[model samples]
Target: MKINIQNYESYCLLYIDNELSAAERREFELFMQENSALVNEFNALQQTVLTPETLLFEDKAILYRYDEMEASLPSSFKQSLYREEAKVVDGYFTRTRIIGIASIAAILLLLLGYQFYFSNSINVKNDKENRQTNNKSLKLKSSKDSNNLVRVDANNNLENNTLTKHKSEIAKANGSKLFTSNNLPSLKETDIISQEIKTQDIIIENDVVTNTISSEVTNNLVSDKNAISINNNNSPILNNTNIPSETTENYNTINTDEHDRSIYIANFEIDGDKLRGVTRRINALFKRNKNDKQK
Candidate 1:
């Protein structure tokens, strides 16, 4: 570490003048052992400052004496002597001006270098901050977009589920209306219902019709047959004919003629109480003779 001799000027001067107290002189000697270069520079500066030799003088004798002293000292020590002389002259405005314009030019160059270094550092720091900010903004936008996409998907799924439930509820209401009472559907209403229920994904429209007719006919037949054979077979009978067997396969066959097409079923389920639902042509056709007769 380079100590600033400027702060210890009095101690350095006392040492130079051989006026230090005995204890202070001992401390100074120990300090010199630790910092020879500093002691040598201080000693040289003190000698130059104490001497009456005017640095700006052009006298040949003065110049010759300076040259002789410079030759006797080591190169490093001579440089330090010149440096000390320059420091003293630098403080005096008149002496600085007298030293020529080149010194002023050198100081200006050092100041410009310092200013340029600081400016470039600030620019680099600003550029880094801008890049970081841009990256963070992009990340935030991406996260927001992802969240929006997720919400949109969830909403679409919810809408589809709601539509399905509504269709089911309509089917149930229609089935209950058909099984419990007599209400004839108009031709126009039938056509509209058929159009609404028919899906191109199903094999054929006629298949759906056939399945409905088959379910109704089978239920009626079983009911009528039971009445006829009830006394002959006294075994307790359960009315399970309303539910279609799983052995019934879905038909993929189709016919171009609208009158000769096969029937297909879309859904069939039994509730906890065994109130069977037979969804054939987007509507439930229940096992009620009065409603069938009306239709």
Candidate 2:
């Protein structure tokens, strides 16, 4: 049979108190023999219950003497003793309170210092970031100004080149013109043939001149198509094609128009492809439907 731990503890207490019957004692000894671990626990309990009293006053006369001496002590002395004890207790509590307050103050100071340090670090980081952002903005602005200056220079160069080309073409056309002299010969067949050939050559030259003039007119038309008037404080009004405009407003407008046209063309092509895809899908669906109907 299994014995409960609580019943064993009760039995051990009863045995220590000498309240167990002989039969119970014999049964307990047999149980202890089966569980040898209980023998040490039983000895420990017995020792605890049978502790020897070393603080007993064996002499009655000494005890009476102590009692008389305590009675003979003055009442003021007893009151002073109690007062000293209260003072000691109060001092101990005061020191403890002081230490607790100091600890709390130190902890608060540490927390404040940490918060100050963290805030300072964040502020420093923000300042640095602001400075960096300002520097980057300045650099970007400078770069943009430089790029504008370079663009202006490039425009001036292009205008100068176009002007030189126009001047050279006009010069070449003037040089190609035939200069006539007032001289005549007696009428003859050779002279007539020569005159015919000269006439044919002059006609050809006139045709060439007309073609060059047409080409020059076409160029002027293209340039005038997107002409822009510039209002510069330092430049005078320029109405002649021999001198091109100093401003890039016309060039910029032409580039913008070209870019917009390119974008429109791309979009148109994309829409056309989408329409073709839709048509193909519709055709495939119709073919499938026809096949299904035939089936």
Candidate 3:
């Protein structure tokens, strides 16, 4: 599942050179997919390989010269050469050592430079912070004095507003009393209209109650008709096979009240007798109230 350091570097080099076999390429692709850092490192390595200009020319030249020398010599001489000499001849190994040493020296210098630079930066930042704090303290003191004056001004304005509001409220209350006592219209005419409105509202409430009852009856009749149609369409054998007599009795007993109704009864069952009675009553009422019909 995981490639070790040795294999990881080798695989990266292979991937960069496009030398991986199909299976190896697939493995590396999957590895890159799972590891974002690896993918980034692979990309950087590829960029370096593609653009050798970014690398140190001295290191490259040292290695290149070593390569020429090794290539010029026989393979027998290569095996017999001393480690240091062999490395000098094999330009890659020698250049790696040189580069490594150079890199270490560069890193040391960078660290020292960073320490000095960061320390100076920290000192500068501390000085800036101290100056900013001093400026803020002065600003805050000035703002506090201004705020105190503003608060006093605001208090005086608030007191003036409160007094004005109090006087206005008293004036409005006196005006309301004067209007109510002297300028108010007579209630007798309004009383007649209000009584008429109350009577009309009572009649409207009765109409609403009646319409609600009638709507309920109509809904029940529609449900009964639908159930009857469904019953007639289904095979008698299905009813006999699937439903038992006791279950049918229980189904019929189930309430159709909105709050406590079973889904089957609410959906399918209806009070056919009550619906018919209401329909007949409505017809009779309609006939009796013919004089009240809208023209």
RMSD of each: 39.8, 31.8, 50.7
Q: Candidate 2: where is the Cα deviation over 4 Å?
A: 1-93, 147-295
Residues 1-295 of candidate 3: C-alpha lDDT, one tens digit per residue: 3565557878898878989888888988887887777777787788877545565557664445555465666778886784654343465557546755665565565456545644655665555434433332232222222212111122233333343233233323323211111122222434434433443343333233323444333223222333112222233323344321111111122232434332212234435455345446655655555545544
Clashing pairs in 2: none
TM-scores for all predictions: 0.17, 0.21, 0.17
Deviation (Å) of 277 in candidate 2: 76
Model 1: CA > 4 A from native: 1-99, 147-295
Q: Alpha-carbon error at 47 in model 3, in Å?
A: 99
Query: What is the alpha-carbon lDDT for the whole of candidate 3?
Result: 0.43
Worst 10 residues of 2 by lDDT: 176-185
Candidate 1 vs. true structure, TM-score = 0.17
Candidate order, TM-score descending: 2, 1, 3
Candidate 1 per-residue C-alpha lDDT over 1-295 given as tens digits, one digit per residue, 9 for 90 to 100: 2224454566777777888878887776677777777866777757765556657756766446555455666788778767434444344556334443544464465456545644655665555434333332232222222212111112223333343233234334434221111122222354335433432212132233323444433233223332112221221111322222222222232342344332322222213121112222112222243366579
Judge candidate 1 at residue 56 and give its lDDT.
73
Candidate 2 global lDDT: 0.43
